[model samples]
Target: MATRPTMPAAAATTSPDDLLRLDRQVCFALAVAARNVIALYRPVLEPLGLTHPQYLVMLALWERSPLTVREIGQLISLEPATLSPLLKRLESAGLVTRDRHPEDDRALAITLTERGRLLREQALQVPPRIVATLGMDVEELQALHASLSRVIAASTPAHQPRR
Candidate 1:
């Protein structure tokens, strides 16, 4: 078997390296965007007494009450291992409760508390502020969102359980 010849580092840079170029790598951009976006959310969420992850959990419960922990985990694209601590914190904060499911003895149901419901009213301001902080117009933001959604759909592992 013949070994392929290696290009010198200088030679590799002479050509337009599609691999290194920003536009060509969706994951690279997405990772950076996710980090920056989360950073933006941090300050916005502080006053609400929620972390970004907790805020997401609240959003899910606010939209639909009485989701099981497993159900919330699936809807939020989180594994039970990752969600357990967050739910524990939320429960401790008096925002949510975990109770045994009536029909399914094995699963635990998660319900938002009155405090959590009231928190939703305060949360209404968060999204608009996030959008404004992005400093991108609606069209740019929409296009970015749609493109990222497509990438997520294509790249996420298959056979994940649905809520």
Candidate 2:
């Protein structure tokens, strides 16, 4: 089987008429890569009882707990409408608690539960597993991440993550 090319062979050389090709579309490439990469996290997260979105929320909390709903949304680039359900599910899972922020009664504060905190230990294995699964060099993945970050920033206005 032929290995996938790391990058396109000189997109600049492509004819103007090929501009409409699906293979040449950045949006198309990003869309498929995003879906496939997220899919790869499924089994890796299953043992921890977290979906990809939930895992992301947990990641944000692990770094710093007791964040407001809006704060978490901003950190994860999710809107309130989309984030609310994930928060609710996390709460129901007994992994986190959601309450009114101490200083701001209107904002919901999310804090990790004891179980959630302990889960972090198991979560530690996740990254290595994913890296092994991809069989990609750590440096290569880091480069890809940086490139993707740039794409995200360029696509988003004022670095406000677009969900």
Query: Which candidate tops lDDT?
Result: 2
Candidate 2 segments exceeding 4 Å error: 1-13, 159-163
What digit string (tens of lDDT, one per residue) describes model 2 on residues 27-145? Answer: 89989988988999999999999999999999999999999989889988999999999999999999999998899999999999999999999999999999998899999999999
Query: Model 2: number of clashes?
Result: 0
How do the residues 15-106 of candidate 1 rate in per-residue lDDT, one tens digit apiece?
A: 66755777657677778879999999999999989999999999999999899988898788898889989999999999999999998999
Listed in order, each prediction's TM-score against the native is 0.83, 0.88
> Where is the poorest 10-residue window by lDDT in model 1?
154-163
lDDT of 1: 0.89
The superposed Cα distance between candidate 2 and the true structure at residue 78, in angstroms, equals: 0.5
Per-residue error (Å), model 2, residue 123: 0.4
Q: What is the lDDT of residue 30 in candidate 2?
A: 89
